[model samples]
Target: MLFSFSLPFFLSLFSAAQQGPAAAPARVQPSAKIEWRPDRPLTWEDFRSRPATDQLAALTSSSIDAKVGCVDYVFSAQVRAVFVPTESWVRDPKRATPQLLRHEQVHFDLTEVHARLLRQKLSLVKLDCEKLQPAFNNITKMAFLTWQREEARYDQETNHGLNLPRQQAWEQQTQQRLQQLEAFALK
Candidate 1:
C-alpha cells in the first residue's frame, strides 16, 4: 500500500508600536502581496492600510507559510515568507522617515529569518509516515514560539526603532543571520 499526505502551517507575526489598542481600522481589498526578496526593500507606498488613531507609527503583518508532505517514504516541504501591505499601516506620511521604514523592513526580514530557521529545522526531518504529523507539529509549534520571542526581543531592544544604535545593530545582525541561512532560503 502507498500512503501520502501534505499539510500546511501558517504562523503570523504582527510588528507594531507598543501602545494600547484603539478602534479598528476599516477593511479594504488587498492589491498585491509582497514576498521577501533581498533586492526589494519596502517603501512608504507599500503600507496601504488606514492608520489607526493611536500612538502607533506602523504595523507590519508578516508570516511564515510552510507545507510539508510525505510520499511513500520520502518527505518534502515548501516554505515562504510573506508580507501583507494592505494589512500594514503608517500613521502619517510626514512621519514615515527612512529610519522608521528601515525598522519595518527589519521586521519583514525577521519573518524571513524565522522562515529560514523553520526550513533549516525541517530539513533534518527523517521519519516514517506515522511519525511525520506529530513531529511536524512539534517542530513548527516550537519554531512559532521562538519566532514570537525574537520579534518581542527585537522591539524591546530597539524600542520600536527609537534606539538608532540598537536598531542599526539589529539590522546588521538580522542581515548576517539571513546570509548564514541562505542555503535554506526559497528560490
Candidate 2:
C-alpha cells in the first residue's frame, strides 16, 4: 500500500526532474500580418514623386489589422531586384534589389506595428501635453533608431560587410527605451 502511494509521488518527482527550466519563453510573434501586393512596389522614384507628408501617410496606411492582437500591423515585401555583391560593392551599396526590397518591406511593417503599439500605449497614459511631449519625442526617436538598426542589420547580413556597430548599439538602446516606455504606458 505504501509502495503504491510512493510510486505516484516518485513518478511526479522524476517528471519534474526530467523537465528543463521552462524553455526560454517563446519569442513573441510579430504582432502584425504582412500582405505583399506585387502590383504596388515602392521605389525611389515612387517615393520621390510624392510629397514628404504624402509619403509618410502612405507608409502609415499600408498596415493591415492583426487577427490575433486586434491591432494594426503590416508585414509584407515586394521584391523588385536582387543584390549583386560585385556591382553593389563598387557603387551605392544601399541600393536594393526586389528581394531586398521585399525583406525591407517586412521590416517596415513590423516597425509600423511597434510604433502604433507605442502610440496607443502613450495615449492610454493620458499625460498633459507638456509632459507627454518628451516621452513622445523619445518614442519617435527610439522607433526610428530601431528601424535603422533593423535595416542595417538586414543589409549587413544580406550584403557583404556593411556592418555598422554604432547602429547596432543604437538599436539596443532604443529597444530598451521602448520597453521602458511600454511599461510606463501600461501603468
The top-ranked prediction according to lDDT is 1
Root-mean-square deviation of candidate 2: 22.9
User: For candidate 2, lDDT tens digit of each residue in 70-124?
Assistant: 1133111111111111111111113323332333334333343344454454445
Which clashing pairs does model 1 show?
none
Off by over 4 Å in 2: 1-97, 160-187
lDDT of 2: 0.30
What pairs collide in candidate 2? 34-75, 79-98, 80-98, 81-97, 81-98
- How many residue pairs clash (N, CA or C atoms closer than 3 angstroms) in each of the candidate models, in the order given? 0, 5
lDDT of all predictions, in order shown?
0.73, 0.30
The total number of steric clashes, by the backbone 3 Å criterion, in model 2 comes to 5
User: 1-187 in candidate 1: lDDT tens per residue?
Assistant: 2322222222122234434333333343467767788977877677788765465777777777777777776788877887787778877655456777778889889888988998888778675676777777778788888888888889888888888899999999999999999998888
Off by over 4 Å in 1: 1-29
Provide the TM-score for each candidate, comma-separated.
0.81, 0.32
